[model samples]
Target: MPQIDPNFVFPVLIGDIGGTNARFAILVDSYAEPKEFPVLLTQDFDTIEDAIQSVVLDHTSILPRSAVIAVAGPVEGDEIPLTNCKWVVRPREMMERFNLSDITVLNDFEAQALAVVSLDDKHLENIGGEAAHPNGKRVVLGPGTGLGVAGLIRSRQTWVPVPGEGGHVDFGPRSQRDCQIFPFIEKIDGRISAEQLLCGRGLQHIYQAVCLADGITPCLNSPAEITDAALDKSNPQAVETLELFVIYLGRFAGDLALFFMAQGGVYLSGGIPQRIIPALRNGSFRAAFEDKAPHQHILKSIPVHVIVHPLAAIAGLSAYARTPARFDIHTDGRRWR
Candidate 1:
């Protein structure tokens, strides 16, 4: 199908699909706000189409003519099975089921990238850093089902989003203590990728590693358990686990900041950051992030912020829908018509 004109892609259905939840919304027109539906659990539905049907068509009198969806995995070919969830996305299938003429699929973090530039102060909380360069490049990465990553750059007047498998990149021990603890952090394919220690399972993985490093038996079984135990200071292992996790998160985020020279800012948006605000603000996360000796000055100049919006991805899609001409998003492979 040929690319659809942005000016005509209205009455769009925008969605942000994650491993645990799927949220839907409708942009009835270019100037109207999105009519958001209730969030649905991914386990409750067998496919994306089912979730849309149950939560959308069944309730709304207004039917959408187009859709812009953001899912938590790479958008390839026609069928997209999410990296952390079981629901697979087929755009052609959706177009036929919904009686649509156009649809565009986006990487979850790519949608987040769009949100970075469009969000107001009410939706963002500054973690640390100097004043942001409004037009400089920006990066958005977070620890969720995986360590999702995406970048945004200004091409004259257009904002172009950069997407890739940045989470799966090689990550290793940098300090003496990191060497001891990282050994037990587990590996995906004989290597310690950033996602291995920066996501939901990453917290638990670090807990087990902390126990083994100190000769203590592992007790916690879930991320929630570790988070609670750490926050309340009830469990020493959990404390170390969460702290180490924050340290590594800061390091990785700092790496990305340098990778893109994200002078605009480094925004954190994922399920975990919002849950552990105290730990992230305790100074350790920022320390590790700014610890890049040679470029510490440069990194310090780049601001850091945590995205506080509960429905950030949805908000990003809404921004694009409202002003599609502002972004230079290519729909060659990800779009269906």
Candidate 2:
């Protein structure tokens, strides 16, 4: 997508930087609602600096002084490591190098969680669960280059965002297969985080683990290829691998709902869930989700939604940037460039 500058009073550059690709959009402030549209793919550039330069240079005749970037990695004070990609975005340096008046950096999951606050029914796909009540709290998790997790709580009139590195939490397995699968992952990664078995690379790892367990030669294809074969029912091992993945996703979602006591429901975002929606819809997921002891009833009532909107993070960023008070408080009173 090419950039557009239609002579608006001011335009804020918003970016969602992930391990796979960096998404850039410019939101113009003029009407009650800001105008936002995609500009380019992140892979086209070698670095975040180059990506930003391309966005600004291609869009407007002048450079904007302020910007906000949602990163797909943990934000440790001033530094962040994009889990799936090579660039590290330093906040202070981003400000200085970009010559911007201000910049806000947030965890990618936080941005996704925040975006849920403003999402309507149109942005979601109900995967056999009830809708989240307007007053209910929502949970969002996804497996991309890495698994991401976040919680949204209703704080008075608005939803307050809570970001977490839950993906790094220990992998919990149930039943015999999961029990068998755990040690296999642990042997390879030394420490088996959920992301190791639940993401894109996780998909590949699962495929290999299944093959290794079955005493068959490991598949030589990539994750994408495996998924394609499984969807077509051309590969039994691939289908079985995906089934285990979906079951784990259900169990994890149930666990997260319990942790949050989320009456609102759980949302599965990220790329993988959307691609494998059919596998997710199978009864195995709901069965695993509700397999909780005694408290299984609580888990059953909490609906699960898959975020289908590609620009959901951007919408959340727009909501964040639109709120002047949130911007001021979080930015430590820094002025917008």
Candidate 3:
């Protein structure tokens, strides 16, 4: 069992590091809410340590005694390499450089999974399905710089987060449109993975694929631009691209639900879901989610919710930092506390 230090000092450093931005916070105490710092763009700093120093250390007078960082990558060995960013973080190096007693690093989605159960109705916008089952298993996933997937299981009184590289799994096309788009995606990369069509870059790729299918010139340069065009109904190709993106997202989410038997709920997080809330609420997403034959009824019963909280990962890291025993995380051989 993991032990929590009752006498741990105040001002514990907490961070949620993603490909696009790095969010930092300082926890004064276990009971008090964390004081969040300004979000720092990941590209501004050459290294993860530099980003931390510039954002957290340069701004605050309170030096943290301990740190808990949620990184968007696989946390395996001492070195945690971000999947989307070039910065490779070394926890022990960070501890020594920052003069911290201990540091715990977690997969970004793992932190999100921990935050799922704690989220209230205010932090969520329901997308589909019936009421969420009270104690059933839950799955949390979303598209950002890359796709992130994690499972939450209620083990007795504690919630355990099961983290994996589910984003890199094979992409299965369910519809005729998906079948047509797969070849274009396959041309870019030999095998079609979930991340290739579900991330920020994935959105752009989808837009390009739509243009290719129509034999038209691809005009949009970025995912934001594509979404803008789609929302404004300025470009038919962009609109179709977004529609396909939603269907793929729904199908992929359903696959995850089936794999995890996520009866509690399917929670969507990250940048894409929140930005495209209108598209998600158009009934197409839910319809695609429940299109599976044998388990259509099962999928319909599982509620879908989009996390609206901006700093959910920070809340989760704080929860773990305060009460380590409440979460059953398999750290491999790593000692978090």
RMSD of each: 1.5, 5.4, 1.9
**Taking the tens digit of each residue's C-alpha lDDT, what string does model 1 give over 96-155?**
888999888999999999999878899888888999998999999989878899999999
Q: Runs in model 2 with CA error above 4 Å? A: 1-10, 30-44, 186-189, 324-337
Please report the candidate that would top TM-score against the real structure: 1
lDDT of 1: 0.90
Q: Cα deviation in Å at residue 101, candidate 1?
A: 1.0
- Candidate 3 per-residue lDDT over residues 1-337, each given as its tens digit: 9965533455689989998888999998889888899998898899988988888889888899888888998787888788888788888888888898877788899999989977679999999788888888999997999999999999978899998889899887666877776666644356788899999999988888777876899989999999999989999998998898998899989999999999999999988999999999998899889988998999999899999999989888888877777888766544344
Of 1 and 3, the candidate ranking higher by TM-score: 1
Q: How does each model score on lDDT?
A: 0.90, 0.75, 0.87
- Which stretches of candidate 3 lie above 4 Å from their native place? 1-9, 186-189
lDDT measured at residue 9 in model 1 versus the true structure, 0 to 100: 67
What would the TM-scores of all predictions be? 0.97, 0.88, 0.95
In angstroms, the error of model 1 at 145 is: 1.2
Q: Show the lowest summed lDDT stretch of 10 residues, model 1.
A: 3-12
Candidate 3, residue 323: lDDT:
78
How do these models rank on lDDT, best leading?
A: 1, 3, 2
Give Cα distance to truth, residue 37, candidate 1, Å: 1.3
How accurate locally is residue 267 in candidate 3, as Cα lDDT from 0 to 100?
94
